[model samples]
Target: MPEKFDIHQPDDRFFKSAMSDPEVVKAYLQHFYPKIAAIAYLSSLKLENSVSLRPSLKRFEADVIYRCRFQGEADGRFYFCLLFEHKSKPDKYVAVQVGLYIMELLSSMVKKQGRELEPVLPLIFYNGKEKWMPQTLSELFQEHPHFIALEPYIPNFRFLFQDATRLSPAALLELVGVLLLERTQPNFVLIEAR
Candidate 1:
């Protein structure tokens, strides 16, 4: 028999734990995806209590969902979901998959039939070998003359995508620039690079 090395590393558990904290998530938004972060009042961010349709997601406890109102407007609420997917290569149907998750979340949120649904922004952090720039719903289809008719009703919304493969050393510096971690995690050695 060949020798096998077994090392227990904090995979999903660490991810779920770290992402559960609003501050950590806030720091991530503030640091990398500032434009999306600006859309919300980050102070009012609260985690929503919702179950997932997938068993894998349930076992991993990877659902990091936050609900908050717009920066200035308090009447309506917005949700931004953080999904951490580590794929070796970019999947073409990633947008469809993300869309399904967002739709599932939306379905779970609706209590009444006539009530309006709050906007939910799906944020994908793609850490993989190849670069991925997420496409909007409209972009997924062939943009021929015949396709022009369907464009208006395509329900276009872009995913807040971050491709880790394309990140430079500067981006790492950018990531840790605003993150001053108080919690000690073996996985994170956040050094504030000027």
Candidate 2:
């Protein structure tokens, strides 16, 4: 067996390259995206080319986007958008950022096919030293004395959050090994070759 490579810096390039691998992505989804996994099979995943919806936004430049079809659902497909944050501290506006990305993805999908927008699973892969605390969009909102009344009007969305810093060593090694292999040879086949 090949030795596992350690990902010292989990930057945008690192994530984009690592997550491009179907195996790595499959493992990631299996572990982090339970809701999607329950509905869709890993074999059904097909990677799509990522587009930059907002070129002017500097922070949105390095996000990775993937589109795939569900195993049983023949008529519909969904997108998976991953945003990597390598900063030591978490961004307070992560919710808003993810929301914008989701809207952009929906708009692109609608324009491409002239059909109803499909679902988008926005995910944040944080590898910072600190533990990620904010799990939902509502958590980022400012608390007010009468916030209950305004809650209904707020545009809210939840993202699957994964903190690599929290993963066990064995699990991390598996993920990293797949990532390194995939990065080295994108066309590297798995089960199909066997």
Candidate 3:
């Protein structure tokens, strides 16, 4: 529970640290990512053990994971994995990195948890200075928009993207208690850990 608007290190690092709080994570998704919060059992949300997810290592940038179950499933045996990634910049190759990470996670899960494959939902949080338009995996591979024929051949999956740069102050008001989200300068956001 630090009490300072720290700006010494990178903002993305601070974001990752703030996300370590389950309350912050829940509030973030519940307010920012309602589509997922609607069907997900937020009460049962729990972070997975930390693991390296660097781009070179076939992982992602701050690949925070959470295990969740559907809200109202009769037999809550299956789990829906939420793969959270935060990017400090606009990365064109992010879809590729996320794809590889998903595959790696599923393979590891099958070995540990029987033959059932848990569904993974990739959620990317971009708090960069510039605006980033996130694209699907297939959209990145398709050089031209007319390449509809290749749609069936390549892997096409959509991800949940939250661009903090585009978020208004009102949208961020609820998260103030867990972590104070403030804009100290034109493009930089200062996060004060609670």
Question: Each model's C-alpha lDDT?
Answer: 0.63, 0.64, 0.74
- Candidates in order, TM-scores: namely 0.68, 0.72, 0.76
Global Cα lDDT for candidate 2: 0.64
Q: What lDDT is obtained when candidate 1 is compared to the true structure?
A: 0.63
Q: List the residue pairs that clash in candidate 3.
A: 53-60
Q: Where in model 1 is the C-alpha error above 4 Å? A: 1-15, 54-62, 72-88, 112-116, 143-145, 176-182, 185-194
Model 3 C-alpha lDDT per residue in residues 24-134, reported as the tens digit of each score: 777788777788889888878888864755446653333588888788874656678888888878999888878877887787777774546889898888888898988
Candidate that scores best on lDDT = 3
* lDDT of model 2 at position 71: 56
Worst 10 residues of 3 by lDDT: 177-186
